[model samples]
Target: MDSHGSSNGLREEEIDAVAMAVIAVVVNTMADKESSSCNMLMRLRQRRALLQSVAEAPDCAATCEAVVQLCVALTSGVFPRLTPRWWIKRRTGGTWEDLRLRDDATDEYFRQKLRMSTTMFNHIVAACAAYMEKKVTHYRMPLPVEQLIAFALYRWVSGETYESGTSAFGIGRATGLQAFRDVISALLQAYPDAIKWPMGRRRAQILRAFREKGFPNCFGAIDCTHIYIDKPAGAPSENYYDRKQKFFVQAQVVVDLDLRILDVHVGYPGSVHGVRVLHNSQLFRRAESGELFDATPENLPHYVVTRGYLLGDNGYPVACPWIVSPYGGIDQGADEERFDTRQKVARGCVERAFGRLKCMWRLFLRTHKTNLETLPQQFVVVCTLHNILLDTGMDFDENLL
Candidate 1:
């Protein structure tokens, strides 16, 4: 009986050694094939079959049970089951992508889709790419800068709903909206000086252009327009209600003869008059301090001498010589009538500038449904884009007017 028991003890020792060796081999195999869960499971199953065959022999049941339990613990819960990382198969062959591949696509096509020439669009992409770039992550790659710009331009020009716009770009609505805001911020940062007031040679050119239009020493035309918005939540909504029975904020713009926006002041409530809006602008303060233009008086016909001035409508106060307004009141002499007529012609530049602005960027044509606080930044961004396009000599289609 002692010899039989000793033989069983020797058998148990051999089985314990076998279990340890198998565990080491399985661990090494799992480490080598860590990336593939399927392979690890297959190896585990093969090893379990081999162990069970060994357990079929005499006096190895208890040791085999212990080995199986250890293997089960290692395979079941010792290591986390790594789910294969994946992304939803989004539609990549969308409008912007297709436009990029089509050889026949023209500047006109780009203008129709993006409200700018292809060259201008590419220029904007180049300028804003640095600000729009994002870091890559383990889950997914960042979107291309061109895609973000195209999505923003499409949304701005088309004035479509976020759902429709996102569908066109094969992105979710929230993603598209966030992309639009990011692009706007990128533009604001990339082109900070795009809408600056002209100086030196540029100012001289603007004066010459206005002089040809029969207004001497004129810098630009200034006016105010309403940018409609939804009812405000914090501010007094009544202050935003305009004469047109719409809630809006006002934008005061100074435009050159070519309808390029030179300076802009936005965010005043629509109920405020143009004169009051002007009073609150930096332009007004600069003009008041005689720092905005050359203060030397230039002589005109009929002994009318004045410095560089902006032509405005009757809505502005004529208290300052720099801000020239049309002669008001019905009973006017022929000379005053002629002066008013010429002033109207030259000041029409501002009106046409507003028209082109709304036509090109139709986002302003509708009541703004997004955050009210962001409207001012968006306004400045659009104005900057407008100046950039003009600087590139890319004019909007006249037929669109």
Candidate 2:
């Protein structure tokens, strides 16, 4: 084949190239017209055919490449623009001015939106600002710390899209997203200090609270909930799909009597059973390896014949020394029945904690639209904020239900 034009009036390759270009234009035009149609299955089939043709196109490599690119653009979505409006592109130019003008509201309005009292929110803003300033280099330098805090909290609590969050925060969609991520990253950096197992007086307080509830040995209640996300395109979707037929990741949490989260383990696929999740958790690992609660048999709870324990639902294993599940079957003694009842009452904390957690940070209940890898970290940030809310004497708002 010649790289330059042929001396003849028209070359064979030129004719083929013109034909392919016409095909590309026609296909793209059809795609744009059908993009918003309700018939998605039909659209998918057409796109699949187009992709196959592109792959099988003959020796005209340049034409094949152009057709392939056009097909991808057409099949992806409606209104495919040549210029992408990603957040980085709007770094210096944002809608923050728009947000400031509309944000004149009462403290209660702020509380409802952020799911925290004014005092609690202010405290966190101060803590996160101070902590993140020392750690992150020139973090979102143009945006005010309060606006950044509001933007992050609004996204987390409302489960809004990044585009909507940007509009609300008066910034570029990408900037709003980056700000939320930076805040969460900074929070994770401080996770060790902010979210920790109770120690000394705190431990004594937790134990005392459990004892008062008629479960003398219970330190925390354990349970798991799924955080839904979009299934990836190339990966095995079945692995991420749950028994409920939804795509999600599992989050296992242990909550103390006051509804404070003591430990959290997230990032497992939803297909995994709750017990299996617990088995894979660091808490379980440490307990099995004899490092978590290194106390003598004499120091263990009297109710447990082997070791100390946390109250858990029937989804957990009864044989695990560190976890106590209620008795099963119809024929049970009165003592067994009574013990089961009390355990149920005590273990209710975990369920309530999850309920409040989801209610306050509605993001957990929504299908998180971010990258799959980033979803778990966002869940951890929500759990971290939940702990912060409980620690600051902030009560779960009943109205959110």
Candidate 3:
């Protein structure tokens, strides 16, 4: 019994020792947590005191003002303030000024530079001046109408880079581009009927000219030419790739014997055939409905033809009554061969017109770099200008061609 009681006493002693160790650990952990809490509180109080001192300091407002000014100065040095309308005052005196001073003495030079006679230039300027005029602004004086017209003409005819062209005109690149666009718009607006279908005396004159060329009741020559252009963004590039492995847009035109464009349809893809392009045009629609010419049939030597027809190459449909395409295949007889020769000569008008148009503008000779959507309008404007130049009896430098 004494042995068991001693064992129990020993166990009780061990339990007491264990309880003392656990209480010591708990007290230490609580003390450590309390110390950490006090330290955090003291730090927070110190930060509050610092903030209060800064707020209450006598020079704090001045300090902030100084800091703000310093920031402003730094920013000013880093990024200078931009002017509302910045421009350089360029000195005016170039080929344009020389031509203006010499006036009629420089008529040939004027025609060479702008592809128009001085009189025609003045006439165009007069017609477009009202539309081209800009209100005088405090920022700068508006460019003169004559200057604008001359710059536009020079740019269009020369196809010079904007940097060089603008430099020649003493204008900014943006200003030069805007001037060209404005001039084009003004021309289109002023001469809406510049490319209209022949009527009354004009129709009779066109018919007479073609009759002299051995094609009776022929209205015009129809053909298509590719206008090279950069592949348009967001459009299928393959659609514009042509047989020459170049990107282009097709323009179908009908021209009288004088090489005056009577009708034009532009903006078809380069890969599209001339027949397809023609079929989709208003010209085809009018011809199909017999609205393009009188339906009265005219007797040819071998055939009776109704509706004035357009002469086209063999690429166009010979099946259509409104169009006369050259005889194809090697088995053609003498009569057919002779007719083909005359037809080819008549068709040459459209080809020559295209050549002259491209040669004069020169812009169309290179791949166009402007927006594709504006191309049709630009082409129409050029064609109108071509007709106007022709009407004025402006001489083309065949040497340039």
Candidate that would win on TM-score: 1
Pairs of residues clashing in candidate 3: none
lDDT of 2 by residue, 1-401 (tens): 45544333235556556566656664555542323345556755665555555445544564457466655655464223232334234443233343343344545676777777666766777777765553322212245676787788888888888888777666776667678777877677765555677777887788779879876546688888878887766667898897777898889988898888888899888788888888888988877887655332434345544434788878887677788888966999998899899989999998988888888888777786766667778888888888877667766679887
The 0-to-1 C-alpha lDDT of every candidate, in the order given, reads 0.79, 0.71, 0.76
Per-residue lDDT over 94-211 for candidate 1, one digit per residue giving the tens place of the 0 to 100 score: 7776657645666667888887877788889999989988974333446678888898888778877777778888777777878988998999989988988888788888888988
- Where is the poorest 10-residue window by lDDT in model 2? 133-142
> Which scores better on lDDT, 1 or 3?
1
Sum up the clashes in candidate 1: 0
**Which model scores highest in lDDT?**
1
User: How much lDDT does candidate 1 score?
Assistant: 0.79
Off by over 4 Å in 1: 1-93, 301-304
All predictions: root-mean-square deviation over Cα?
A: 9.1, 16.4, 23.1
The alpha-carbon lDDT assigned to residue 83 of candidate 1 equals 27
lDDT of 3 by residue, 40-80 (tens): 56644643443343333344353344335434533442212
